[model samples]
Target: MSKTCLIVDDSSVIRKVSRHILESLGFEVTDAENGQEGLEKCDENMTDLILLDWNMPVMNGIEFIKALRARSDGSSPKVVFCTTENDVEHIREAMSAGADEYVMKPFDHETLQIKLKLIGFD
Candidate 1:
């Protein structure tokens, strides 16, 4: 079966762009407007991978990762922090929160694909 991916970001444009890229790479893509919605969707149907954004109106990516890792279902999906936060501290924070990889914003298909491959997605 094809792998599933969840794109969590407040920006509609980012979600749309990520959905297109992930779909092109053969992923069954789903989207959420914020971390809360992302968590809700994950509870309903766990994804193989999650592309998360840092800043949002509701819960942030780090918060979501922490909550997801705390789940008892063993649903540890590969999480990639896709955000504009490129500082070292933020990256370390994300890793500490259970993110498998990181990707900066305004990424092209190649960069995203590289991250996916690094996380064993393709």
Candidate 2:
């Protein structure tokens, strides 16, 4: 079976781009526009991985990560912060929040593929 991935982002463009990339790489992808909706989706489906955006409305990535981390063992998805926030502090904060990986925005297909592979998603 193809691995399932949930993409949480407010931008339609980012969702479209990520969907295309993940599909091309053989993943089954689902999407949510914000953190709350992402949480709802999580409750409804089992996601193998999550690609989360940091600056979304109605619950930013940090809050979302915290909430996910607060869940019981079988409830949380493996998450990677895929965001525009590139500062060292931001990366550290995401790591501290339990993100398995972090990838900066404006990434090309190759970079994304490599990062995913490095994280054992490929």
Best prediction by lDDT: 1
lDDT of 2 by residue, 1-122 (tens): 88999999999999999999988888899999999999888889868889999999999999988988888843346788998888999999998998988888977788888888877876
Clashes by residue pair, model 2: none
lDDT of 1 at 21: 93
lDDT of each: 0.92, 0.88
TM-score for each model: 0.97, 0.94
Reference-based TM-score, model 2 = 0.94
Best by TM-score: 1
Q: For model 1, how many clashes?
A: 0
Per-residue lDDT over 1-122 for candidate 1, one digit per residue giving the tens place of the 0 to 100 score: 99999999999999999999999999999999999999999989999999999998889888889999999852579999998888999999999889999999999999999998997977
